[model samples]
Target: MTTYHVQIKVMPLKDLLDPQGKAVLGGLHNLGLNGISDVRIGKHITLQIEAESELSAKTKAEEACKKLLANPVMEFYEIEMVQG
Candidate 1:
């Protein structure tokens, strides 16, 4: 098995309500950061995975995201894999 590094980004669906993101944006605006807009808060997950091939590593990461890391109903995830 080869060691791989995985990056998972999980975020709220565009149509769903993101109170945390909105709160952050409001705070930023209050702080006088006017140029920032459409601010969305999300999770950035990094992990090490062992698999037989690059494809397998990606599959494992994506599966983890679907099954445990991300909420399918209200959120979406993107995965990036790289060999360490």
Candidate 2:
């Protein structure tokens, strides 16, 4: 088995409201940071996975996201296998 680095991005669905994002946007506006029309907050996750190959590492990371890291009803996830 090889140790691989995986990065996962979890974000809210586009159609759903992101309260934390909205709050940050409001703060930005209050700070006079204009021209930025939108803000969407999300999660960045990094995992060290032990697997036989990059594909296997990615698959394991995907399963982790689907099972525990992300909420399918409200959030979506993207997985990237960096290096082994």
Candidate 3:
């Protein structure tokens, strides 16, 4: 088995309301920066995994995101794997 570093980014779907992002956008405008638009906030999770190959590591990381790191009903996630 090889140790792999996994990164998972969880974010709301486009149609979902992002209150924190909206708040940030509002604050940016308040600070006189109105050019930025459609700001969004997301969660970044990083962990280490043990797998037989890169493919297996990726698969396991994706499964972890789907099962525990993200809420499919309200959020989507992207996963990245690297040698650890």
Best candidate according to lDDT = 2
Expressed as tens digits, the lDDT of each residue in 1-84 for candidate 2 is 899998899999999999999999999999999998779999999989989888888888988998899999999999987854
Show how many residue pairs clash in every candidate, following the order shown: 0, 0, 0
Model 3 lDDT-worst window of ten? 75-84
Model 3 over residues 19-71: C-alpha lDDT tens digits? 99999999999999968999999899999988899898899888888778899
Model 1 earns a TM-score of 0.93
The alpha-carbon root-mean-square deviation between model 1 and the true structure, to one decimal in Å, is 0.9
lDDT of each: 0.90, 0.91, 0.89
In model 2, the Cα lDDT at residue 33 comes to: 96
Pick the winner on TM-score between candidates 1 and 2.
2
Ranking by lDDT: 2, 1, 3
Candidate 2 deviant stretches above 4 angstroms? none
Lowest lDDT block of 10, candidate 1? 75-84
lDDT of 1 by residue, 1-84 (tens): 889999889999999889998899999999998988787889999999988999998988888998899999999999988657
Ten-residue region with minimum lDDT total, candidate 2: 75-84
Better of 2 and 3 by lDDT: 2
